[model samples]
Target: MFYFFFESRGNQTDPVVIWLTGGPGCGSELALFYENGPFHITSNLSLSLNDFGWDKVSNIIFVDQPTGTGFSYSSDDRDIRSDEEGVSNDLYSFLQAFFKEHPQFVKNDFFITGESYAGHYIPALASRIHQANQKNEGIHINMKGFAIGNGLTNPAIQYKAYPDYALNAKLIQQADYDMLQQKVSFCEQATKPCGNQSNAKDSCDKAYNVCGEIFNDILAIAGDINYYDIRKQCEGLMCYDFSNVETFLNQDPVKKALGVGDIEYVSCSTTVYQAMSADWMRNLADGIPSLLDLGIKVLVYAGEYDLICNWLGNWRWVDELVWSGQKQYAAAKNGSFMVDGKDFGLQKGFGPLSFLKVYNAGHLVPMDQPKPSLEMISRWTKGLPL
Candidate 1:
């Protein structure tokens, strides 16, 4: 539960947005240094200000959670979390303590935001916060809304988009798509019992394995292409490398600056990933309708180029969401998401929910299209148009 907070450079009263990176096990420092943090790690192993960092418009917190990721750790194995309940509770506790300690920013508008697997994390955590607030939770957080970027929220709906996305992107042939559709059909069947109805670990784990093969099948056809950004090729096993973040964080002077005495920086922990495996196929989107019903704004945005958690999947899930605003949202005309008077993406929304499809970017929207991503968030948190 180690977190880094960066004050807003624009306004002290601006919203506080906490960022969570997704590996199901990745640390948020990856977002801090590489994506939307105040600074970027220079080639000389030093930090340089990032002009497009989100902190320019709002206070930002990048946290490492679930006990085994990043500098956060526990001696007890019981501390390791396997599902959203434990994960959400831990984050709720952290926020309570954080707001209590930093009372200066307590009244400022708060937002939950992250990329990738954070799709799963954000909705669950939001539901937890809303429930706790309803029960007269301590230190009422002025939560305004949350935004997810390239996240995997509804596995059943999202998984079904895999074959169609691959075929539309021309990454696979018609025959390959035909085969993948069968995999999707099997995945849907396997995932049914794991939906909002049950939390059976064995059933969920089986669904996770079965649905995962869809991606493996796509990879088998599309070789060496980065699933994060289909436009690029992986250097090795990773589409993009953050070894430099690891190197810089491990530096003696850097660790001392951060007061992380001798704690090794883990960019991603496989143990945490394995622990959360059975929770993967569970439909996190099931929690969203309630949040939206309470007027908790949700913005689901995705980088169109990503294959792993592609915009197609995100769009489908958001569109298929059964909120009160569902009909209006479906009927809403697609609008241009403009940055500097030019269209950077497409967006659609009604009341408390919105979806944006960012162009010319990948899984990490902020990293691929920095200025526009910053513009998107600045407008979003301020209740301005996207």
Candidate 2:
């Protein structure tokens, strides 16, 4: 694993926060360079630093995980297909090596944060850390908490949050909402009868496909184009056309300043995906429950506009959690919120120890709504009232 560290100006002994990138395959640089970090693309597509980067308040480390993301790669030709356990083990090992190298940080409070598929990654890693803490006496791992943005935590809830989010976004008409609701209800009621016999996997795939079709139809009517093209257009709004791809591909100066190497594949690389898939499945089945039982704080956030891991799905998943004090902190309305203090209206809430549904955001919440995203994260890490 390769890490990108942002030192705190306050003190070297200050708490250290580790940021994980989603995808089971994604690298942290994508978040560092493209999202809520110090760098943003100008309207002319030039790189500019965001003044509100989290680095201003605390030391942050972004990790390229599972040994195949970013600059990290594996020489073994073994199929990197992993579940949840593999992820936890690898991360546990990485943490050991990481702290050993930066021994000063061994006692600093640490937080694990991420988005998207990290809904799974963060919990699994937390579980491993907790287990290690128990196994080793007097050698404590000061794991404070974890946070996720627009996460994919529970499969069932995630699949179900579709029509509600669509209706709120005004992407689907009232009639379409009624019809889809009926279909969804029927699917839920007759889950067994509709069986292709692949268990929940087949059912979820079917449900998601139906959900995707509904959203696709809505986008088709609104944009007069295919959903893929609309997504491409949206991404184009933020992407910079670097004049010298080679120079930009070199290790980012910001990352270098933070003490990381120039790594290949900053974003969507095949190798990253292979390692992620392997790690996610392994940990989910065995690793995650261990951490939750240890009382490690886990916060999962979702962006309402993100069709990839829609708020509907996240809401559904969260609802399935058996936590006693879980409550809905924010309500879903139009693709925006009315906040009393903040200029950028944020739909804020606190319940069951997780934050969900930032408004006006797509799959990439930080890219679409950086200010609120950062604020949510800051408040969460500090254990402040949201």
Candidate 3:
């Protein structure tokens, strides 16, 4: 189960947004003191208030998912192994237990949102929440919808789009792009069948390895470019500068302040990573069409400049999803995403779903462009268009 909680400073009536960061291993703590949380770390390594935190418009929950992420730990190693089933099931249990303890929030409008691998977590977990709501099961959560940020939902379309993304970004020469282009069809073929839930683990794993190589080598030419953002030098997780966060978290005083006991905090857990990757190639896009059909609003927004889970690939998959309004959704033109009355991104919506291509952000939108990211989330969560 997940652990810890970070409540936002806002009106009690605000909708609750459960935020999950996508490392498959990275804990929510990354999102807590950084990203969309109420506070951010300063240059001197002290914390400062973020006026644009998502907490301004909604309450947020950032939990260490699986059994061993962040402060979440278990005596049994088996508890650490997290596949899609464990993530979705444990999150469902967590919500039930969470709402039980905090009964006042049970009926409040709830939204699930996250970035990166959370593309997998949000959809799978949202499906469970919706199903439970249908059965009028325990808690009867006021489940509204979910949003994913630069997530990995569909591999076939995404994998095929890599060469074009790199080429269009002008990262590679024409000859190199032409050479890489030949490999896409086969790679996409490998990814296409692997998304099926019925596919065997070995089969899916092999496909991910085969097709994922397309984007994996994007930086091979540049040699030092950040995979998260081709716009910057590779600077490690959190863009290297936030190494202080790891330092601060490891301190005795900070640990005690957060009620984290004797356990040492790691930004990411290898055990959780391995477990989540077992079926990493599984087609998460399978759940989207149905989830949308249930009247659950889905927001898939990607930062325009990201190399890993880039906006082009995210848009491709959304356009490819089959649903009741597929044709209409496909034909819809993008509307300017405004922040502070200024255009900041582009959004296209149909059938309770929308896709936004945020400008100049990367894999972590909040970290790169915090103000715009905050406005984007606040507006969208309130049923505002983009």
Candidate 4:
């Protein structure tokens, strides 16, 4: 039972945007209803309508995928196992089932988008879809492009983006930046030995530790950042609260949005974790390469302010892309551009792909900068000359 949001505008057959939530264990429902949906919360904690939902121009489907997310679950006693291949396969099955249930959408244009660890999910799913298309089997998914915000695609690239993003946000002092850079250099040198190891390198571990230390030092100097406080600023917007998991799970609004019944868990369920761990192990090697080879367009976006999946780490991973003939796109300095009638910013970029950095945004760009995020996505999906 997957939770989804559907919209049909007049006679236009808009693309079906399947939005996947991040966290090899996270729920896409949370991203939709809470993080950046068309609904906001009232001062009394009641729900209100959001005017900027993606439904305005497309049929959006927010799924709690891979089973055990939100309303989606599996009764097969098989131990929950998740990997790039397994997830890709599971998603394919789900799409098959979904199309059967909603046959009218069989030929609708489809696009996949997600955040965080979905960096892995989106690419793998895209690859699977591309493969199925090759065999002329399953529903004809009019897949055009993919998108992610503040994603965890390439661990290496994500790690390196930290200091630069910090500097841009004015969150780090010059002295601190220099210190962090030296530490990064040392971590890079140390990671050389573990380059070929299946397990992540100790150097990479050290690099992450050093980066964490830099963040810690910044907090020490400027006071710790309050994520909840940031959420309060967007008071009416839907947000996640893991405090009382049971109550949160049973909440009517959440239940309705996620299309889940009672007796289900929210946030971290055993099913979700198993699926995530399985996927991690399977894709440890050759996952990204396998996807790129299929001619599927894999795009990753990052919010500069995000610390969890920092731009530095993501960048580190992307730099490892070995696929030939791949191109890169760069964003303008001011980071501002126009799409439709809306003005959005450049965010960021690597080579042919550009990562839009949402100013003042955190790990959840939609929550922090919903309008800009939406605009950026609109342009991306259209493949417009941004």
Candidate 5:
């Protein structure tokens, strides 16, 4: 069984949302404390309430996935699914059991959400859920929509936007900027094989090595800066010291409370990352149009200041999506995203598709601007304007 940390207001009228974190291995335990989950990690290394938690708007399940991540583990190494398809199948089964165990939530409207690598996970899982919903493949879920923050949905095209994003953000000089433009061609060529699932695993491995060099080039120029947030410099050993999270979860009391015995805890799993390496560069954007066509809502939000999966690339891919309202969606005017009478960000969306450019935020938008993030989810989940 997967380790799922469930939180609810117990309001039967509200929707249920399953939240996943990226890394293909970054367990949702990180999301539970670090992002939109109810708790905060205090200086005392204990849990505190987050006023802007996503649970306020819906019943949320924070899952530690991929069979070997966080508290969720299996003795069989092959039990883990390295690709997006296996991950989705595992989650689908987990959800089936989850609803069976708690039948009260079965009828509630449901949604799936995640960030970073989940860009790929969300679309893949959504497709599976969509298929299940249509074919009666499993217990019917009132699947509503999906939201991704600073996700890597379309790495192939998103990679092309990085050089321009750096230039526009003033992170690179004209000489360096031109160099990035020159590298874009090589990066795209190298990324081709990995862009499709039909290619050999070796080709995908090659794409990661070849295309990743472009990012490495940018990192060389912008030394000691946070790739997740360009406005900030790298913090401590791991860019941001989540050591406390690792430390906190490892406490005996916490482990006992979580019901996972004797298993080691980590914020992310390196083994899972290596297993998922080949699927990393494959384009998830290809799945979005079909998802939208299925009438499943797609909300892609990005932090304006992030460098890794920057806003430019996110917006570009959303606009590139082919659908019934292609022209109107592209021409839709961006409006201020207001919170407490203050303009927090700008949003432009139409029909079931929407994209928000979160101002003054980074890769983890909720961690950066919690109130606005909450408002964004609450709005989209309720069919409110983007």
Candidate 6:
């Protein structure tokens, strides 16, 4: 694993947060430079301080993982992970080694966080650490909780919400929504088998293929709008471009400073993404109830404008979660999410679980609303209300 660690600019006692970007294969550098990292790339490729960087409130680590993603690579093909077990195990092993080398940060409260597909990664990794700690495994990590922003955690439930989200967002008409219901029903039926432990990889892959049509249908109807944020149109193949990130990292001076030398930076590995296709429809939410039972905090926040991995899906899964606090959480009314005395969103939380619907933002909340996102992290890590 290749990671960039930035210590807290506030207090040394601040929590340590490990951030993972989605794509199942996207490098964490996307978030590091474009979202919530300590710096942003300038037009001239110079580094400029991100005023609302998470490191201002806590120590943050950006990791490129699962091998062959970003700056990390492995000679063995077996190192590529297709499922949460393999993914979580690799991260768990990294944490043990990391804590051993830097014992000082081991005692600090640790947090797992990320966006997009990290919805799957964060919970699985948190569950891995929780189980290991209960069993008295190597290196008892002082884990606090986890947070996900616009992530696709429970694909079955999330996939089903596609048509409803489209309808509610005014992206589709009543007639189009009524038409999409068939696709939604098909996705739901196909995805059910994926939740079964005895299911074959072929079954999961089939489910992924079937359920993907729901989003495909939406995109076909919605035109060129960015799936990450419906409010924006894609510039090319991507809604937002970070070509400068590639250009900057490939520079000899930058490579030498980072000590990566001549190793090519693989921005997004198609090999790893294709390998993990079968794992896409599996419900990662199955492991969260156990972690919640152990009193591990969870925060699921979403940007309202995101079509894929929309707020509606995340809210549905979190609300329908079969946990001890499910009733209280369901009964709880949303409160204003204030930043500097202005309401930026709505928050619903009870006990160890929280859900936020950020206003006027998209899939990448920090990039869309930096100050509010930073305040969100500050409040979340401190166990304070939003």
Per-residue lDDT tens digits for candidate 5, residues 98-215, read 9888898888888999899899888888888888988987789898889989999888888889888988888888899887776788878877777758445888788788778778
**lDDT for each candidate structure:** 0.91, 0.60, 0.81, 0.60, 0.86, 0.89
Question: After aligning candidate 5 to the native by TM-score, how far in Å is the CA of 324 from where it should be?
Answer: 1.7
* Of candidates 5 and 2, the better by lDDT: 5
Tens digits of per-residue lDDT for model 1, 53-144:
99999999999987789998888999999999999999999999999889999999999999899998999899888888889888888888
Assess the local accuracy of residue 55 in candidate 5 as a C-alpha lDDT between 0 and 100: 91
Residue ranges of candidate 3 with Cα displaced over 4 Å? 1-8, 237-239
Query: 1 or 5: which has the higher TM-score?
Result: 1
Between candidates 5 and 6, name the one with more favorable TM-score: 6
Residue 301 C-alpha lDDT in model 6: 97
Task: Tell me each candidate's TM-score.
Answer: 0.98, 0.74, 0.95, 0.74, 0.97, 0.98
- TM-score preference between candidates 1 and 3, better one: 1
Quote the positional error of residue 175 for candidate 1 in Å.
Answer: 0.6
Q: What is the lDDT of candidate 6?
A: 0.89
Per-residue lDDT over 295-317 for candidate 3, one digit per residue giving the tens place of the 0 to 100 score: 88889999998987999989999
Q: What ranking of all candidate models by lDDT puts the best one first?
A: 1, 6, 5, 3, 4, 2
lDDT of 4 by residue, 6-28 (tens): 67442347777888887666666
Score candidate 2 by lDDT: 0.60
TM-score for candidate 1, residues paired by index: 0.98
lDDT of 2 by residue, 42-76 (tens): 55545787766667556788777756766666767
Q: What would the per-residue lDDT of candidate 6 be over residues 57-149, giving only the tens digit for each residue?
A: 998889898777898888899999988888999999988988887788888999999998898888889989988998999999888899999
lDDT of 3 at 84: 75
Give residue 357's error in model 4 in angstroms. Answer: 2.3
Error of 6 at 249 (Å): 0.7
